[model samples]
Each structure stands twice: as C-alpha cells, then as structure tokens.
Target: MPTAASSPKNEITIVGAGIVGLATAFHLLAEGHRVRLVERGGVAEGASFGNAGAFAFSDILPLASPGMLRKAPKWLIDPLGPLTIPPRYLPQITPWLVRFWRASLPDRYRASLTAQGGLMRFAATATQAMVAQADLAGHIRADGNLQLYESEAELAAAQPGWEARAREGIEFEHVRGERLAELQPGLSPRFVAGTFTPHWQTVSDPYHYALALFRAVMARGAGLVHGEVTGVEADSRGVRLRLADGQVLNAGRVVIAGGAWSRPLARSLGDFIPLETERGYNTTLPPGAFDLRRQLTFGGHGFVVTPLSTGIRVGGAVELGGLKAPPNFRRADAMLTKAARFLPGLRTEGGRQWMGFRPSLPDSLPVIGRSTASPAAFYAFGHGHLGLTQSAATGKLIADLVAGRRPPIPLEPFRPDRF
Candidate 1:
C-alpha cells in the first residue's frame, strides 16, 4: 500500500503540523507510507488550536462573495463591526484587499461557493471516518448548529439564499419566535427567526481533536519535528525541506498547509500566493451558571457563541493583521459583550481572549492541487474561515494527488496558479 517507492525507509516530509498537515500524514500512514511532520511551533498550537470548532456543512458562501465590497468601508469604520482593518497594517495589505474586492464579482463568487460547498460535503464524511478511526467520538458533538437573526425583515430578505442552499441539498428547518424558544430556550426573544442546519456539527475543543489526530498518527509510527521549514527544494526525483536550522529532510512530495503563514513558504518555492491573514479572536469563560445546548451564531453580531465543556466560548471577526503581530484580545472581549445582548443571562466580564490567523485568498476557494512551478510540491492552504470544515477533504485530495490518482472532486477550480 505504500507509495514511497519500494523502500519503507523513504521519508515523506510534511511541512506543517496543523490540522491539514496532521490529517495528511494520517492518511498517508493509513496507506502504509512513512511520514515526517515538521511544525514551526507546537503541534496544532497555531491557528488550528483556537478555531470556533463548527463542523459547518452549509458554509458555502466565500469570503469574496458579492455584497461584501460595499460594506467593507463601514465594517472597517466600526470597531465593533464584524470586519476590521487596523490602521497601521492598511498599507501592507491594501493590494490584496483590492484584489479580493475585485474577486467579489458574481461570476467568481458563485464558482467559489460551488467548489467550497462540494469540498465541505466530502469533508464532513471524511471527518467522520477519521474521528471514528481515532475513536475521538467523545470530543465530537452532534447538536445541529443554529444561525439566529433578530430582524424578521433580514430573515425574509435572506430567503432566496436559503432556498438556493436547500436546492443544493443543504438540509435546514426554519425556526421563529416560540419555535426558536422551544429549540433553544436560552436565546433572547429579540431573535424573531432563525435557521437550523441539522447536518452541521461541532467539536467541544479543537485542540482536543488535534491531539487525537497527533496521537493516532504517532501511534502508527510517523515522525514529527519541532521546527520551521524556511524553504522547499524540488527536483525531478523528489523534494527536500530546508529547515530554519539549515537541516534538510527529503520526501517524495511536500504539502504546504501552514495556514496564514503559507504565502512566504509558498513563495520560497517560486509560487506567488496572494494570501492574507484574517485574524480571528476568541474568549473563554470560566465555568458559570450559563449552559448552552448547541452552537449559536448571532446574525446581528456576526459571531458564534458555543457552549464549551469547560465554559462558554465566543469567537469571530476578520481583522487584517499579519500572522506574527501581537493579538488584540479586545475583539474577543467585544464578542462576549455582544453575546450578552443576544442571551441576557450570558456574562461578558469573566473570560480571557485569544487570537489566531485564518489564511485567506482573494477568491474564497483554497489552493488545493499540484503546482505548475514545481512538480513535486503540492498546495493546500487558504481555506479562510472554513479551514476546519475543509481540512479533511483537503488531506484526501493531497493524498490522491501525490499517488497520481483521480481526485474525488475536479481540481481545475482549485488550481494553485489561478491568480
């Protein structure tokens, strides 16, 4: 089953140890291949650690979808708004944002949504399979996710969108007033109507899931290195990873899944990936009287509040801050304050904040295929806010690409050089 030639000792080096990298290593090991996963920091301790944890099935809209460009200026003005661009970093990322604005055209938007939707559907199944194989069912919760809206007018206006999604086979049911209370008694009565995507799921802790994957892969005898890969050297025979410490590790193929920090690593291999970090924030509260049964997304606030087994967790926002900058925890605190408006009983004062990067491209679709620049290198980053939803499927696609097998989905839409 191994694809690394006839020698079992051949190393298949993976450049990042986030969800995508670890999952790819898992799949490769499943196929009897030896792998070495190298991370810049601790495993899964990057952006993958503090995600909102929603296993979204209908998060079909791309970040560059229509109607976002006009709202950008306003969203940037309001500090409490869903999207923000820090004044200091504007000069550096403006070009990328301009390209992103252009990609928001209807044609590109539709294509991105379709491709991401298909990948997300396949990812849901792959997630189930991998989790079951690792026996991590305890960390997974099957409670369907609810998207709440306070205004009936807004809900009515969004009908066409929901109907289109339904036509695409995304299961959902409408909930209003009393029905909303019946389904989630903790929600504020101000939320007049909402939609419940019964197919969606959530993980109690993303770190726990990553830990599970790490343990499973290590148990199967894969190797892991704690270092940053500064460069990737590719040739006809294979690829070699150049680490920060100047050590080289050879592999038949290399996967770039370094999240927001992927652009530079990708560039070192001669690919120009116009990627930016959509920095997201999260707040974790100590256990209190507030208990929630399902994941909650406030349409008005543009954030999600999920009931973590430890305490309540709130995370959202798209700040154009680079990956290495210090995190502004105020955004996460703002999320808690915003959550209080939706659930009157929810406390806003007693939680700590965290921030991490979400790798984003001008177009919402991620780069998930072989590179035209380098035959032995592969690209799988840029999932935006849907990294968790897209990770598993991306891994399977990478495995199929390396094995030279037909991918489950067409690869043209996600070509690395579409720029």
Candidate 2:
C-alpha cells in the first residue's frame, strides 16, 4: 500500500500545456507542490482550443464497437465520410487497427464501458468545481444536449446505443414534434425525432476555459516554460527534460501529458504505447450564423452544432492521417455542407476552418498511472475526444497518485503498461 510519508511534496515538471497538463498543474499547485509546466506552443493551442466545447459525460461509448468493422470498408473508401483512413497510412496503422478490432469484441467492449463510466462518474462534479474555482461560470451553460434523427427508422436504429446508455444509468428523454420544437426553436421539420440528456453540459468557450485554468494555476505559483520538448530522461532520483533550443530542465518528478507528441517521450523512458492521432476538423461560423439554445448533434450526419461565445461551431469526423499530414480543410467544408442541410435556414458562409489532432489509443482509455520505467515519472495522455470532459478528474487522480494516496477510481484499466 502507498502512504503519504513515502511520497512527500516535491518539485514537479509537467510537459504539454494543453487542458490536461494545465489541469494537472492546477491540482499539484493546490497541494502545495512546486510545479513547472512546459509547452511547445501557447496554451490551449491544440485540440484543447478548438473542440466542440461539450462536457459529454453521458457519451461513455467507445469509438470502436461491435458493428464498426462491418462499416469500415465503406467509411475508408469515402474520403468525405465521418470516418476516414488514408490508403497510404493503412500499413503503418495496421497493428493498431488489429488491436482496435480485438478491443471491439463484446467482452472487451463491455469492460471498456465499465472503465470509462468510472472516470466519467466524476466528470460533472469535477468540471463544475473547476469552473467555479476559476470564476469561469459565465463561460459554461447547463442546458443539456440533443441528438436528432430525421425519421422514425433512424431513431429505431439507435435503440441499441440507447439501451447501453440506459444500462449505465444515463438519463434521457425522447422527444418529437411539439416537444422537440419547444426545446429547440427554429429547428428544421425534417428532424422528426430527438433524444435529450439534461445531464450534459457545454462550455461557451473552450479556449477561454483552458486559459482561465492556466491563469489560476499560475496564480497558485506554477511556472510556465515556452519551449518544445525534444527528449526526456528519468532516473530514480529525478527527471530531466531536453528542449529544442538546447536548454535542460530538471525536477524531482515528471508528468508526461503531451497529447499527440507524448509517444516519443514515453519511448525514451522505456515505455512503448500504441498512441495514434485522430485528426479532427471543425468550422466556426460568425456569432449570428444560427440560433441555438444548447448543443445539437445531427446523428446521421456525424457532426455536432454547438453555440459558443465566438459563434456556432460544427465539429466531428475522424481521420487517421498521422501527425505530419497536411490539413484537409475539405473535411471541414463537408461538415459545413452537412450542417447547412441539417438546418436549412442557417447561414454557412464566412466560416473559419480548423484541424487538430486528438491523441487516441486502441482501447479508448487514457494512460493515467505511474510509468513502470521510472517511479518518478507518470503518464496522462491518449484521451481521444474526452480530454476536456475528463481533464479535472484526471488531474485530481494524478495528484492523489503522486501524493501516494489511493485514487478514487481503479488505475488498473488505465495503467501505462497495459499495452
């Protein structure tokens, strides 16, 4: 058993200043530990800044499910489809794809749900706490989210997912006609059916939320280093970080939370993980592009329309095009086209497109425990689309682990060595 006496407060260095890294720094600083946060770019520059801004606690289903393999061929062939895999990248990703297939088995799928549910159970409360602490309550809305279907058959086809959610005790209400229109006015009449989950939340500005957290952590005495981390070396006594500019920094402990760039650092520390990048694209319209009271998902279209402080953001779709691939803004345009079809009256012109990489693993779970290679090193990356949703809880759990206190949730499922 781990004890507090065995793990005293020490100077800590955290790599990556995205949502996850900043959240970890916040927790550690609150615990009276000295913390230094390192980032290649500015804060919230990656997926943390451009996400859909949804705190989707009810979306516990993994991306790889039983029926996905059957649809893979079609999705792979359709360049503009919701899921795309570049033909050139197939050989490089085959091993990871194989693991993804095995993870989609009935048994493994259920286990993933259980493990994901355990982490999401803390999502709502933790997010609320962080928002309140950072005085970012103005940037969040609790109006819930809607998943719309165009026809009865389409709604019927989603029964299995609803059943799974029900088994997990997720609350939802089915609506149509007047009820749907009452909840979301001006919606197209083509959306004949909808499912609403009131427990879901949204951030009016994801980048602002991250920046608020970063400022709060800094106020609490955490240092920020603006440099690209080239390598990391860890020993029993401490960890050393190498920068691209030939600067070296050292700390008594280190946490590697560098989203898509984490693999190289982890490999240097002797822990190999099957981390891949899920290239995601989004388009942001002007402030008055559409009127939306809450977040809306066009299920058939595989995209979400969220009301943000800046404007309306339509984001979704997965592309396995690695980190070095050029941005495919065409994917963003396709989403805008779909969004226009979903809401015929909405303006789709003058929109800004963006592409960001989401760190992902075969099992759809983040690595969130001590690295076997070094006791002073910890892992907290590969969160897929749930990075913003699980950031606060992950931060608290990591703080507990570093302090030698038992985590609120089991770490076995998210262990770094599980791969």
Candidate 3:
C-alpha cells in the first residue's frame, strides 16, 4: 500500500467545471487545500449556462413521481411536450426507465422526498454565502418565484404535490382570482391561481454567476486545466486522471463532478449508477423583450419564464436523448410558443435556442459521498434540475467528507454505493 507521503499534502483535483464542480473547488480552497479543476469544454457551457436560472428550493418533489407515470403516455406522444422519450433512445435508457418506475413506489418516493427536502433546506443560506464570497451578489435576486394555474381545476390537480410539500414543511402562499394580478401585474388575466414561494431565488445571469465562482477559485490559488479526462484510476494513495491528449494528472484526492458525463468515470471506479441524460431546452428572448418581477412557471404548459439580466429566458422540457444525439432546438421553440401564450404581450422574436444535458438519476437524488472503490475518490453528480440550487450545499458536504469531518446533513441517502 502507498503511504500518505507519496502524494502531495492537502491537494485535490476535481473533474468537471460546471456549477457543482466550481462550487466544490471554492469550498475545498477555503479549507486550505490546493485544488485543480479540469474541464472538457469552456466553463458553464453545459446546463449551468442555459438552465431556467431559478433556485427552486421549494421544488423538492422527485421528477419520477407516480403522477408523472400516469401522464407519461400522453407526454411521450407529443414530440414537443414537457417530457418525451425518443424512440431510438429508448433501448439505451430502458434500464434507467425500469429503475425510475421502481423509485416511484410510495415507500421509495416518500424516502426520496424526505432526503431531498432536507438537502434543499440548506440551499438559500449556502448559495447566499457563495454569492457573497464570489462577489456575485448583483447577479442574484431573492424576489421569489410563482407557479401559475390558468384554472382552478389545474390547481386542484396539483394538490398531491402541495400536500407532499406541506408534509416536508415547505411553505407557499396560495393566490387566486384577482389577487394574482396584484402580485404580478404583468401577468396575463388567464392565470386565475398561483402558488408563490418567497424563499425561491433566481440568478440574473447563471453563466456569469458560474464564471464568477470559477474566477474566484482561480484567484484563491486553484489551477484550472482545460482538457478532456478520458479515464480516472484511484488507489489507496491517490488518483490519476488520463487526459485525451495523452497527459496524466495526479492528486492526493479526486472528485468526480462531471454532471451528465459522470457515469463512465463512476463505472471505472467500480460503481454502476443508473444515471441518464435529461436533454433540456431553453430560449432567451432579446433584451427588454418583456418585464417580469419574478420567475414564473406556467403549470399547464410545463415551462418557466424567468427575468434575466440579458433577456427573458423561457426554459423547461425533458427529452430522453442520449449524449451523442444532436440537439433538437425545436423543443426550445415549443417553449417559446408556450411563453408567448402564457404572457400574451411578451415579445418572442430575436431569441437564441439552447439545449444541454441534465444528469438525472432514477430516484431524483444526487450521488454525494466518498467512492466505495477508493477512499481518495468522491462522487457529486446526478442532480438533474436542482444542480444550481444544490451546488453550494453539495460543495460543503463534499468538503466535509474529504476532510474527514462529519457532514452537516445525513449522507446515507446520497451515498455513492446506495444503488
């Protein structure tokens, strides 16, 4: 066995430069560890760049809920619907689908909900600290977010989720009738009811926010390496990363935070995770296209329209296409169509379409613990839509685990070996 002195003292190398990876680097740097970040592409170019930008802390419900299964048939039929599975991608994702179905069972769903709710409870404070540390306070808004329902029937259908949230101690204000307009004057009269969670926050510019954190990490003495990590090998001493360009990097510890691309590395570490890519789409309208005081989710249309520093961003939609498939921008166009109808007066021209992969697990829970195959390796991916919301808290947890300190929250549910 290799001794501790064989590796550099207090050094850690992290793979992936997305929000979660950058946030982890920041946290590890604060702990007096020398850190290095490796990225295949430019920073924040993945889901971090084009997400809905809402820190949906109140949305603790798992995506693979029992109700979602009931609606799957209808959604799958519509190519541009909120959720669709490409017929060609079905074979590749069938095992993940089976796991998703099992996770939707009442017992498993409750357990996931409880675990997710606990992690989200620390979102606001953790993210606020990171924002302040990274000097990104200007990029964040704490005005809350709203989920709109065009009719009372639509709101009634969402009661189960609301009840689950209530059981988890999640709070929200129910608005109906004329009160909706008072809360959001710019909203269309079609929205008769809404649920507002004041604790939900939004990033005025998600890409910039991530970049700020990345720069902060560099300024704090962490090095950033631009290369593709093809494989990772860990042992009792440390870990070695093989780059595509025939370069090898070694560190005292390694963290796999590659988001949608983490599965292969996890497998190399002897952990087989049921991680799948949820291809999500977004469209950002031209500057001043519309005015929105807070982020709004159109419940019936299953999309979110958010106010950003650059423009009004309309995003939301799930396509189960593997990583190799070309992006289907039509999904983004469909979101724009829904945004136009949700806000009748909004301008939808001069917008850019984007699509990125969201790392999703069957249970809708992130893997955030030390690797079972190697003590020097850690895992922190499979966050799906909550990556931005949970990044800071996950970073703190990873730092704690690496330093051999007890985590602030329970880690049993998020163990890498759980699957």
TM-score for all predictions?
Answer: 0.95, 0.96, 0.96
Count backbone overlaps in model 3: 0
Query: Candidate 3 — which residues are off by over 4 angstroms?
Result: 1-10
**Where does model 2 exceed 4 Å of error?**
1-9
TM-score of 3: 0.96
Report how far residue 317 has shifted in candidate 3, in Å: 0.2
**Per-residue lDDT of candidate 3, residues 1-419 (tens digit):** 55664344346989999999999999999988888899989998888998988889899989778987877888888889999888999999999999899989889988999899999987767888888887988888888988899888888999889998888788898998666776677777778899988889898888988988888999998888999999889887678899999999888889999999999998888888889999888898987887677899886666888889888899888899989999888888888887887787889888988888999998999999988899989999999989999999999999999889998789898998777
lDDT per residue (tens digit) for residues 1-419 in model 2: 53543332357889999999998998888888889899989898988999999999998888777867766777767789888888888888889899899999999988988888888987777778877876778878899999999999989988888898888889999999889998888887789999999999998788998998888998898888999888888886688888999998877899999998899999988899999999999999999898788999986766899999999999899998899889899999999988887787789888889998999999898889998899999999999989999998888889999999988789899999887
For all candidates, the clash counts are 0, 0, 0
lDDT (0-100) at residue 154 of candidate 3? 85
419 Cα displacement, candidate 1 (Å): 0.8
Ranking by TM-score: 3, 2, 1
Cα error, residue 94 of model 2, in Å, equals 1.2
RMSD after Cα superposition, model 2: 3.4
Candidate order by lDDT, decreasing, is: 2, 3, 1
> In model 2, what is the error at residue 197, expressed in angstroms?
0.8
Error of 1 at 171 (Å): 0.8
lDDT agreement with native, every candidate: 0.82, 0.88, 0.88
